[model samples]
Target: MEHPSDRPAGSHEARDLTRTLMRTEFRERRSVTTELAATTVRRPPRSTREIENSLRRRLGLGRLGERLDPTPWLWGWLGPLVVTALAAVMRLVDLNHPTRLIFDETYYVKQAFSLLTLGYEGDWPAEDDDENDAINSRFADGDYSDLVSEADYVVHPQVGKWMIAVGLRLFGADNGAGWRFSAAIVGALSVLLLARTARRLFGSAALGTVAGLLLAIDGVHLTESRTSLLDVFLMFWVLVGFWCVLRDRDASRARLAHRTAPIRAAEESRAFHAAADAAARPAEPDRPAEPDRPAEPERRGRGVGVRWWLVGAGVALGLACGVKWSGIYAVAVFGVLAFAWDLSARRAIGERRWFTTSVVRGGIPAFVALVPTAALTYVASWASWFAHPGAYRRQWAADLRAAGEPVPRPWLPDWLNSWWDYHLAMWDFHNGLRSEHSYEAHPITWILQLRPTSFYWPENEPPPEACGAARCAEAITNLGNPVIWWLAVPALGVLLHTAIKGRDWRAWAILAGYAAMYLPWFAYAHRTVFSFYSVAFVPYVVLCLTFVVGWATGLLRPPPHTDGWLAAGPAASSRRGGWRTDEPTRLARFLTDDGSVRPTPTAWAILLAVVALAVVAAAFWWPLWSAQPVSYDFWRAHMWLPSWI
Candidate 1:
């Protein structure tokens, strides 16, 4: 905090030691020059922000940015929007081509229509052994006369079905595209959300657009987008929660800094004056018993300011759980993550009692904001089920009392007791399911993409469509891009290392998604699980790959806490330029780096190669992913692994 001032020019030491100091300084500068001749240059430690600015200015980054994109605010948003439009076009085009349900669309989309017609899901009649295809064809034509009014015993909640019902209402269930319009819209929005979230995490528009591109081309995402499935909505809401938590972190930190500024200034001034007074004292013990130095002001706050983002996260996560029970994992991880962030912010601002303070002030409020809100939101998702008494198990408690059976939760009202019983039944169905499936994959192989589910495969039908050859394969397979998914394997490992070694927040943020979406599936390995479930966490896989790409592009060459990254990092969330007027930003820092850091050319080449491979893979597999009729031989060739078949 204090620096030794230059001695008076006429002082004895100034005259005697000046030559020696000059010689030492010359030797240090020469040694620094010699080090610069080699690959790495160690930066001399300095006590102010100006050191970094001076370094960037010397490296030609400060002025170059002024010349190109004098203000990058517009481009940051424009870039992700452009990529999101690409995703929208891909998802929305030809959404009605097949005209029939693919895989679980038979169950979900029909249930959505049933919800629209009746107050709850109604079952379709199964009068004949071989009537499924005939029924699907009839149903696609809007002849739901066979749809029964009885409540169907569905496992998942009603939120996803309600989403599909929106599209069906708008476009009419008779039109085929209406079945999937909701999915297509949510899917495209997921890409935009992922791009925007990545931009917030990494602070670069180019990186955000790259994340969007990867997700857009990813096979499972594209297929799921065009199909009326539940996982994409689950993914979207979880991402919403994740983004909200990030916003909460920034908001809380900014407020903490604002509150503690005076305290920090007092500490710095006290430190500087103390050092000067000590230097001026005579070199003797108990010299005049100098006035007792003042202690630094208390930096601890009553609490971090209002974190409305926690409320947003609560609602988003609740909606996610409304889609699938698996979303509960995010609810857990994000709650602790947000509390930890508050604690970290307090400590960063020099709070000596951060842990206790966070628990009393920050943690309790965050829990109220996130957990209870999500629970209530999830409970509210079943409102329609409660309102419709004919819904499955809606009168379980009343029946049990009439039949003289065990009355579970007797203290609750009969309807709530029935709802609990219904949820228990759903849980039992999910927990005990072990039916064998052709495309089931363990969690280990999800990242590897070894077994992809075939949602539609008409090649082995009674009379397969002919291609240029005797047979053809038109299929919709839920697979990810081989390059990005496979590439994330190593990137995930590196993120683990970085989180441990560098204590980076970005890695922890991403790993939390993997922990929720991917790891919990291992608990259900014995159940009939499809590889398609990996779609819930696919955004994080793209983010993992992008982390390495960030390194390659030199966006992360300097510690993100420094001006190198934060200069533009805050601006990602900041409305216009949130940078303090004197704050410096440099684009060349992303192209090249200061002495201690340099652009990794080899890593950049590898990233470019990865992008090319993904492009090629997308081209080769587009027909199959889109269910276009391709020659049987071509489809077989696209199946790189026999297990994929």
Candidate 2:
């Protein structure tokens, strides 16, 4: 190469030889750098914040803007209160009409009056006996003094009668207002509860108001509220239990979030320091110190403890059972629901053994919190019966002991034995009831509201002052809003689809509530169940319908890719040559378009139309729902189906 360079400076061979040497040196240096990088230990970026953000998103707490704020107390109570006031007016107005015992009121009202006076349900004469009318007349005239002292073998629990006793104490148990007063108040309060529950469940106050409004005006709910019936009380307690469970879900998630925050922050700080040191000392062998981080918290084991809200739910469900045995179904359903929710929560937080941990650790605490509390509350509801030694079955253990017969559960106390015997007898009575009545409907038809029970229907009278027709009718039929009830049939189907496909927790919870309240009736199809029993689950039906309406109207969430339409202003509309977008928006804008401001047209129209239709339907059926007098032709006109007749 030196000889070639001396011969010619610009020779190709000489230049090539020089380039080869330079390339060899570059290759050696590159190989050394690659080997050093391969031997070095690189620390990954910290993921604590990322993991926490993911968990928050999974728990639906990430979007704080979508949630009602701390002052929700003011807005929350305002809408529900208005709806409850409407319910109160509907239930309390002309409450004492017909001035007679209707349907099962013959049993419950009389028993309530007896409980108020005798601290127990007293016996009543058989229907065939002439004294039945005399006892009823005395009860009607505010005279409860001559009631028989022997304990009545009632089939239901004593708590509902206790509630009725409250009304009797306040209003003097003679009038319908006195007997139905507490039911009315509870029914109205149910509206408040349902509204608030919906608000929390759907994260929208308007939807909650809609749900409450529907419940307030539904004829079946109104009829049950205005009657001295146990179903309304049962419904109230079940709803309270459901609401409490929802509260627990939120509170538990919040607790988990609170517990994990500091751990995440510490991990992030260590990651930042490690990263900074590595960057500053690139020439030296960069060694990241093993951070003195705290042990990773168990995601499922000790994050969220057994919640107090669950205990509240248990107490509420127990009260439901105290009202009626049917309420136990809610306990069973919601117990499973709470556990399932725990599983979902753990899984969402990236727990490895979510199912096993949820069952083994979470299940135990939840059971201890909910089941035992419910059992204790149920037992406590029997306090009045426990106190009244002369009540029915209260002497069963004493009689058995005196007769030298072995008492059932001899290890238990006398009161416990007596209570168990009473429960056995009650269960037997419920299972064996084969009584027939004209209004008795199959459970299958109850959902459709095909054969509504006529709570009150005075005999038609023909007179000059009678309703302006040849024959007059005044009746209170426990019918539902045709639009709402009929619509719920399909809405429930939609809920089932979403629950399975989307695994939406809300849909599953609501479906569980409906199944608990409804599906059990199939087992007792042979028994005389009435359509009025559907009242207990009507709030859920309305909720289902409201959910569907919200989705359809884009109030709950916008349809996929339709957010563009929401963002599109009048200018965009003009640019698109006035091409309309969403149907709801188009219809709403067509009906009430004001050029100056943007409006949630679709949501407003759907809500207003549904509410208006409900109001009109209620008005059309008001005479029948409230037992108000109407002409024969007018009453017949309201019979939309032959089954309704």
Candidate 3:
């Protein structure tokens, strides 16, 4: 997992990027001698050649590389596949065990069936119905007969419910498996996506696999997968957008390196000739005029070609916003991050107009690709609501116009105006949603697992015969794996240190995602929120811990494959320059000639112990995650903290 900023580390990649293209003549010239007339031949003077090399180094050519990730594609994909398969099994096995609507599933799953039946969210059976002993008792038995004809004033967007509707359509809505199939499928796929993304970000398949493994075993992720809810879908799309952004960075940088290659070669050629001419000018008065300086074609109005990856990211994040409004935070943060990445890339390539060029070449294209694409896709997600005017708030514009009232944003069509109205209403509902609940938790305590939301427990029902104990507890709790979650708190500290002190972009990227998912809730701390919402950032937490663990264990560094001088790390340039990972930029410190950064025995032991403990924690918490029936004493034993109960 090489962190070589591709900013040459006085390493092989640097030598190949610069020296192979232009430095060979400066360092490897030979003077050929002929004995025919006692003639003497000499090479160009040293001072001029040395100056050119100095300029090239100062230009930061050695630090940038064309290739980004060096991992073999096979391992990159295979590891994620294996981890995804494991996650699928865990999510799918006995998924219907609880066989009841739990937590928010009671709202979303039934809403999904409502979408299927009415082409819009419809009200459930009335409160006074004789059969409505519990809210969904009849609906649980597939008796969806009492659905009200009116649209229910649904708070969230339709995209997530549409996803649940896919499952209900496929497996029939009569059972738990049907309600949850899409969530389980999407959740497992998120594991696959995270692993592949980690491989690209860290340049190591092993580290990526470790990230996937942690997410697969997380109690919150596992429980959410086995239930139908919106957040899991929201998490999946945000991850998809994050992965796309990483690809866009690589693609743009690779292009920058290519466009600048010819410029570097031209400059080096000019420098070599000018030096030779100075040495010869004193000896011969007759010399042809120095040719006019060649024009730099690429530098003038440098065009940033179509950024398809940025467009893809916008679309993916738009889908996320379609699931939940909280997704807007990622859209905003990522837009700025993309611009910053472009600014850094241009500066790395020695553009004199780095700032202005970034605006014209990178920033403008980025905004165009991301903003409009995201906005259009977000609006497109409402296609169904547009088709069915009976949907909640779908006819507000029409109703207002018919009553002789002026519509807000009347320039837009009626459907769009109505969508705007619906959004306003949703915003109002979210702002004032302060109704208290037992499961509400503060964002500050989320890192410590200080409070966990209970999704399911047979509060008033008798112990089923299958429990095999007089006092058994069956539950589905949205808690975290204690070993992993607690350790991640310290891991976050490590990430913050690396991001601020070492300027590791990967660390900053992870922190950005973590902040996007977890921090915004603090603004609404007075409102009803649950620990389960933390599932949205579980992937980032896993990456943070995996990144720190891999670094400390030396698993993040790639082994040496070249001679000692260039074998250390990325070009020595990255250390003096502004970017790249901390130790790799300093030339693989403490490196063996043949290999570097091998994990010490003690480091290996600690890593092994951590993995083993996490596995044990997963096993101990599986009953709660999966809603398996356990003896009351067994359930009590797993609650290490009072807040868990």
How accurate locally, in lDDT, is each candidate?
A: 0.76, 0.76, 0.76
Deviating ranges (above 4 Å) for candidate 2: 1-54, 62-75, 127-130, 264-300, 459-464, 558-604
Instruction: Tell me how far candidate 1 lies from the true structure as C-alpha RMSD in angstroms.
Output: 10.7
Query: What's each prediction's TM-score?
Result: 0.81, 0.83, 0.81
Q: In candidate 1, what residue range of length 10 has the lowest lDDT sum?
A: 565-574
Best-to-worst lDDT order: 1, 2, 3
lDDT of 1 by residue, 1-645 (tens): 422237666777666677666667766664554344332212222333333233334221342123434334555667679989999998899989777877899889889998988879888867673586678878888888878888888999999999999999999887668999999999999998998888767756667778888999999899999999999899999999999998887666655554555455556556556555544444332223344366756656556556789889999999999999999999999998888777765655446787888898889988988899999999999999999888888877998899999897799999988988888998999999998877888888999999999999753632354556677667888888898898889988887876766566777888888998889999999898989999999999999998767764455433345222112122122221112233334543222222122335564566578778888888888888888877778888888998998
User: What are the per-residue Cα lDDT tens digits for candidate 3 across 384-495?
Assistant: 8888878888889999999999888989888888988888999999999988888888999998888998888876644657577778888888899998999999989987
Q: Highest TM-score: give the candidate number.
A: 2
| Backbone clashes (count) for model 3 | 10
Residue-level error in angstroms, candidate 2, position 104: 1.0
- For model 1, the local distance difference test gives 0.76
Candidate scoring better on TM-score of 2 and 3: 2
Error of 1 at 336 (Å): 1.7
What does candidate 2's lDDT look like per residue over 195-279, in tens digits?
A: 9887766655666888999999898898899999999999999999999988887777666655665565565566556545544
